[model samples]
Target chain A: MTQPTYDSLKVGDEIPTLTTPSVSRHTLALYCGASGDHNPIHVDLDFAKKSGLDDVIAHGMLSAGYLAQMLTNWVPQSALRSFNNRFTAMTQIGDTVSCSGKIVEKFEKDDEKFVRLELYSNTPQAQTIVAEAVLVLA
Target chain B: MIDKKHIGYNFPPVTIPVEEGRLKFLAKSLGETKAIYTDPDAAKAAGYPGLLAPPTFPFMLEIDALDLVDFMSVLGETLEKLLHGEENFNYYAPIYAGDSITVRKRITDIIDKKGGALQFVISDNTFTNQHGKIVAETRTNYVFRHQ
Candidate 1:
């Protein structure tokens, strides 16, 4: 997809959403190894049980990565100026996540046009992340 | 409660290479299907010199450069007791596979919330490529939930 132009975008415009498959244990383990985030709370069932959770949980970065994918799908990775997110809830196993973003602000800074997007991701149960991203417009 | 004195403490910097194999592995792990993230030839076709580091890939670099267990121990806490509250990344330049990334981290803030039931630890990490160019800056807020 081509990058969105500054004159073509409007505030409150929603970008295309991206959805991913269920959060399986296999996915979490793969992320643990690939990301080097060996936090057992995400992959070790016994550790999660000892930590007072009934079962293991997904990594927050995994969902955040999904949101990133959503933005990159809309704009090139090079267009990204900043990306931020708050992990509001835990994403559970077997939850298929959907990510969406809307343009919140558009303005010119230092002769460069930019758009700020309010981003979000949710499981079937509840919202897991609330985020914002800024992208430079072509 | 974490000691406020630790605020502004800087961690020893660590540098690691952006390996192509790891980038491909991460892309696969995230279920990323874009060839620009997994194939060098495809990336070149897309005008990228090499496989582009997917957004949030720096989190992998951050953790790989710093041991979370040792980082938490410095604050009198453990990994299991902490939860990710918030994360922010500002990009200055694109990071491609084969770049050497140097990470410098420092504790920026530590405060209590919920009347001490929860403590928030805020740290900022600056990532610079081998050319001495700042590529990205990440701020992470960790919630220490007291049992």
Candidate 2:
């Protein structure tokens, strides 16, 4: 995909969405080690039940990583100026996450052109995360 | 159970050198297929000094620098009842492999909501490269549910 130019973007342009296969325990264990977040609630089922959850849930950052993946797919990591997310719902095991984003606004700051995007990752059950990102446009 | 006195708590600084293998591992774990994240030659061809760190890669570094379980223990909270509420990052510069980064974090605020059933602990972290320049700053909110 060619890099998006500042003049070619509109306020409501929707970015191509990214969808993942159903989240699995194998993926969660990999994330735990790779992310350095050894929280038992994400890996230990007994612990999760003790936490008042039926089963282990995916790490919030892991879902955030999915959003990051979607953004990086649309733009290079270097163009990303800021990324933020609020966890609205838990992503249970076996849930597939779909991340979508739409350009919200375009502006100039410090003589650099920028675009703001409203982003979210959702499952069939709930909207797992909502995010906003700012990226530089060349 | 939220206490304002812990609002000013500061964690000791931790310095970690970025490694190419670790970056590649994290990128692969995220299912990233970009060459810039794994191959140093490809990264250099793309004008990057080394393996390029992904956007959310800093989340792991921060937690490695300061363990979240340790942080929760300081507040008298257990891991089973804690949940991540939100996360934010502002990048001022790119992070490449071989850069030694130091992180410093401090508790910024503590708030109670839902009639004291939920408590939010907000913290801010600053990451500085070896050159002593600020590279990125992150804000993280952790929520605890009182039973």
Q: Which numbered prediction scores highest in DockQ against the true structure?
A: 1
lDDT of 2 by residue, B23-108 (tens): 88787777878899889999999999899988887777788898878887788878888999999999999899999999998999
Scored by CA lDDT, what does every candidate get? 0.91, 0.90
* Model 2 Cα lDDT, one tens digit per residue, A69-135: 8988878888999999999999999999999999999999899999999999999999999999999
Model 2 chain A scores worst on lDDT over the 10 consecutive residues at A69-78
Tens digit per residue, CA lDDT, model 1, B25-56: 99999999888998999998988878899889
TM-score of 1: 0.98
**After superposition, candidate 2 runs with Cα above 4 Å error:** none
Across residues A1-138, which tens digit of lDDT does each residue of candidate 1 receive? 676899999998999999999999999999999989898999999999888899999999999999998888778888999999999999999999999999999999899999999999999999999999989987
Lowest lDDT sum, 10 consecutive residues, model 1 chain A, at: A69-78
lDDT score of residue B49 within candidate 1: 74
Q: For every candidate, what is the interface RMSD in angstroms?
A: 0.6, 0.8
In model 2, which residue pairs have backbone atoms overlapping below 3 Å? Answer: none
Model 2 chain B: weakest 10-residue lDDT segment is B25-34
